[model samples]
Target chain A: MMVSLRTKSSFLKIYSWLPILALYISVLNEFDLNYLNLEYFSFNFPFILIFFFTLKDFKHFDYFLVFIAGLFNDTVVGLPLGISSLSYLLICIAAAYIRNITIRPNPVKDWFYFLFIISLINSLNYTVLTLFFSFDLILMSYLVNVFFTFTFYIIFVSIFKYYMRGLND
Target chain B: MASSRDDFIIAIRSAFLKKSTKQKFSLLTLLSISIFVIVLSSLDLKVIKYLKVGINEIVYRSSFIVSIPENLIKNAFIQTTEYTTFFNRYKRNIIELENLKSNYVSNEIIQFENKELKELINNYALSSDKILAKIIVDHDSPFLKSIIINKGSKDKIKIGTNIYDQSYLVGRVIEVNYKTSRVLLLSDLNSNVPVTIAPQNIQAIVTGSGSDYGQIKYIQSGLSDALVDDSIVYTSGTGAIFKSGVPIGKLQSFIGGSINEYKVEFYSDFTQLKYVFAEVITKTEIIKPEEKVAENNDETNNPLNVKLKILEDELKIIEETNRKFQEENEILKNEINDLNFKVSNLNNQISSQKKTINQFDIDNQELDFLKLNLKHGHKCRRTFLNTDGFIVGTLEYKSCVLSKGANDG
Candidate 1:
């Protein structure tokens, strides 16, 4: 099957804004398979999505909208306001920095870098929630979240890349 | 080294301040705003609170709408699993329902009596009304466990308002908005409840393990040994955070390496919760009896005066009863005297009749003697007949007449 896009049409317009839309939906829906009753079964879909799209510096992915999505996430997750926004913005900054320094990105290298970024973000989240906000958080959960997010990043990257290629065409 | 430092500075500055063509704000600006919001929200300002509530109301609704497909898939998956054990679950549910039905009436009675006692002890009556609330969002996130409910300030759901699943304590409200509230489930790590272990009567705190169960913590050191498996765990009402005697869970003992570890398996399944009840409590102070009297009347008669009045009324009743008894006694005495007089008159009449009977007996003897004398008149005449006879009117004449009559017979 051949795929093509009609320029300036509503479908194309919606297609261009898919990443930001995904970000909003991810924050709002929080698609964690928690009902599976699996112990330690969670991954940060927004983290992986944000890292991949922001690293590509996608034109339609708005930073302000990301910040707003973070706010929505905090509300839905019952976290202190702006906590997720800080974490999301921090991911954007890290992705931006990595983009600036690398002329050509290797998937393996970006994957490892994502592992590091998510670890740092999760640790930062744990610290801020526990110390600053007086939240009782399990360190193990954060570790598990980091591990799952890191493991899923590469799988999601392929899908995001396919979308990127479709947009380019 | 100086060139490398300059390159690093450029990259950092570009990352912080550079905005792409489609981006409205740089990363640094959003980050600063996030930090500002965090600080402001932490401080709990009125404006910030209202703003947060407004955001929560909208976001919770949006989340509910957005989570529809996911919730559908989740329910389908759960229902598929539930069908495998359908009969067993049904049988178990039937048995449980029977037991619960039996306990329900007694439990209600105990709860009502408990409320009365609590009111008496607290000097205020707490009339709690539980409002039904729909669970708008139940993420069951591992890090922070909470759910958004459809009851809030409009439904009188305040912070710390207890949430329940059919009388089972599930959680408490931590955040409230206009029509939405956030309940921190007992399975959350931050959720700590003061609880009592039954049969042992030991007190401890139950903190959520961020899983399906709660860990018993802050118990007295040696009291842990007394805890047995399947012991009841209920709220102790310490810290005034939860109502006393609200059942939380059952205590389960597990081996944690060398020592026994105790955990509370919550009575409510947080994952399956669709609707919950939020208790809205209103406490009205109890007016003392004296105060009630003073409010109702200004006669100034207190409890002592009331008691005295009751005693005086009792005395009057006793006196009236005694007077009636005396009047009855006087009437009885008059009747007895009249009866005695009638009895004496009857006795005199009896004696007169007895004397008249004796006179009649004498007249009958004289008549009998005159008849016998006429039959033997010549023999009965003492002077003409024989010298042995005496005067005719003497007793001897009568005897002689009777003897002559006997001799002639």
Candidate 2:
């Protein structure tokens, strides 16, 4: 209920500059920046990690935020509206609810949660799309997307949280 | 309480400050994530389309690729649906063909029966000499009203052959090919047949005047006796076009002019055509008048001819008288026919009048009898009592009672 002024200002700086950075990266993403093909996963993960780290106290509204993000994806990506929305909401709510219920959180626990949430979202998205849209959502393709995104997000978010701690000091 | 209130204000300000930064970062991060997903999804879709097209092309190029188990399975699914549709169409066609075949066979049998009946009837008409030709095809030309028969020069089908179906004369063969002959029907523009007024001996050239009903032109004068529905016009075999006595058609009803050159009606049903028979030329016999005269002179020189000459002179005289007599007889016969017809009609009228007179006489006699009874003092009596006393009372009846009795009687 009581958020500090310093935390609030840091959050503002992260959110305000975040879009310009994301947009620049998106333009960069158009280039096939295969740095050993790790960028493929790193591309979407960094942005999502930044968003995920913003979930501090009001974790209940995270799925709603993810749902809005999914809508934007639905329009821009031309995917079925409900498909990505369902997957994003599933991941956000699960992460947020677990964070709320758990008494303690560690890097290992965070990584596990992150991996599970991404994989669950990707696999469910694939399955739903394949069944309803009559597309062949091969398991290998879905796994590739999930693992890369998870690895990149975990690494990036860890590094990001560390830098934020310095800013806090 | 004041310190606590100040702390509460500080708390509210801090809350707003935290939300402001978080909201900006969250919105920015979410926007970036959404764009990232969209681009990735589009790339994936393009790759999928490319892969699919490549696979299809490989399968198309190599039959071996198409024959692969997976490809074969896919093809079988597609082909089975196609085969089911084609098989249903084939089955329907087979059923329709079978139905048509049955009807065709029955129609053929009926045709055979008709042909047999025709042959039987034709045998009666030309009992001694007759020909039968099957109708192979009939190209009924509305423009020409002509029919082409299958018979040709091979079947001795010649020009001037009397082409007749089993029923009536269709036409004579005009143009003959090796296998086919064209018949100029009596209804054709350029076709004409010399038809005679039957039983009346009045002849007319029934010319085809561009219609199914022919024009009976060149009818000799003084032939008004041609009655409607009277006789069937037959070919006179004069022009050697058609054989004599081929039943062409019957005289249908016609309007006659004062000049006796009336239109002869024909009953030739040209519409119903099937088979026709053509009578061929038998011999090339040519006898001129001069040869016949020389033959007569040679025949007169014999001894039997001397006696025959006397008989011939007498025959000549008799022939002369007979010629005059025939002329007179024709006039007299015509007069007699007219008189007889009039007499028959008058007899009918007289008989009818006699019947009426007899009825009137009977009525008059009854009336007179009623008057006599009334004069004898019969008065309004409903009934007469049979009394033993004679002439005790004369019963009378009213006119109404008498009328009722008359009706009852």
* Per-residue lDDT of model 1, residues A26-118, tens digit only: 899999888888898889999998888889988888889999999999999988899999999999999999998898888999999989988
Model 2 off-target regions past 4 Å? A1-169, B1-130, B225-228, B255-268, B284-409
i-RMS values of the candidates, in order? 0.8, 28.3
lDDT by residue (B276-365, candidate 2, tens digit) is: 667665543334323344587875455675556446545655665566558767988999999999999999999999999999999997
Chain B TM-score (each prediction, in order): 0.70, 0.38
lDDT of each: 0.88, 0.54
For each candidate, report its DockQ versus the true two-chain complex: 0.60, 0.01
Global fold similarity of model 2 (TM-score): 0.28
Instruction: List where candidate 1 sits over 4 angstroms from the true fold.
Output: A1-8, B288-409
